[model samples]
Target: MTGDNAVNIGSPQPPQKADVLARVCAALSAGDADTAKAIIDTDYPMVIGTKAQRRYTLTETLRTFYRDGFLDRYSGTQLIHPGALRTLSMLLPKEFPAHLNGKMTETHFAQWELFPTIDHVDPVARGGADDASNWVTTSMLRNSAKAHWTLSELGWTLHPPGDARHWDGLSSWFTGYLTDRPDLASSSGYLRRWLRATRVVQAERA
Candidate 1:
């Protein structure tokens, strides 16, 4: 990664996928249980709630909670202060597999080459969270090409086999996932302002 946020590293030859994933796992194991319980659940989704509910891995679910500034979506009266979830996310990072389901980044990665980019189906610029519901894996090439463009704006379609190659599939699936929690769809105006403030700070450094 470069010091400049706006600059994309071309032909960036970085670490191997296994090495990167291992490090990510290490950082996660060190986090709190609320974060770990949701992540370590390899089974993911455990089970999707009525059609109203969408499937997601523990990791993505927690990322969403953190991104949206919450302790847990199912928990009542517990909330993480605004931007705290993002703060924690910045400190303790995770990735979304190419597949929205836990299968995206499974134990066997040798089969799926090219490291995964766990990106938000929705952009944080527009109030997207880190939740699995809003996240997906894609080629770094596709991600760089996508830069800030919404799924529909890209005019891509999802195939029935559920291939991750289609960058647009992530967004389409997320739209359905949000059927259960539309409130999580928009980050608070507070988050938008905070993001802008931080970007200015970053730009000053750049």
Candidate 2:
């Protein structure tokens, strides 16, 4: 597959939220629950350590960064969860902001541009192992664009991994947000899961 169909995550022009929603609607209408399900389940549990450890080392331990050279955020509230967007799109389309519906705007960044996901560097379809070594961190947008294509096929190159020492993906800010809005933890299992994992990692470092 050529990169022509891929959305340029590095570009100043973002993809339209309407376009993405339409894709999801089409997938669902066509009885392609798997596609809609994949779109809805964009959360990366590995980043937060909420996912169970594998028998071998995991790609989850890999440093987080946008493959396209954009800034990265920790896999937390800074990144919009697909579940949240799915709900809003269904119940509140009327109230959806014009900018979000028109062209993809800053509001959609959390959902598309910056949401971290694990991708197979060498796609499994082409015989790449489904293990840690073959996996890398990428934005949900790029992950979708890259569906089953190799880097050479797409004429893309792998960027270096990020160092937490320099950029912690606003992890400190996430900690502070949780502290200040503790009540949100009760309603959001996502927040609670990350909070627990964050504390565990912090304790280990301490």
Q: Give per-candidate clash totals.
A: 3, 0
In model 1, state the lDDT of residue 89.
31
Candidate 2 lDDT (Cα, 0 to 1): 0.52
Sequence-dependent TM-score of model 2: 0.50
Kindly list the per-residue Cα lDDT of model 1 for residues 1-206, writing each as its tens digit: 55757556576655554555565577577875455454434323233222213345433433333343322111111232223333333334453122323263332231122223445556655556645656654433455566666677677442221222222212223334333444643544534444444334324434
lDDT of each: 0.40, 0.52
Cα error, residue 19 of model 2, in Å, equals 36
| TM-score to native of every candidate shown | 0.25, 0.50
Output candidate 1 Cα RMSD.
22.7
For residues 1-206, write the lDDT of model 2, one tens digit per residue. Answer: 35879766566564455666677788899999888766544521112212222332211232222221223222222232223343344345556422334266524344566555667776666566676677666667787888877787688876655545445455555666667767755666755665565555445545
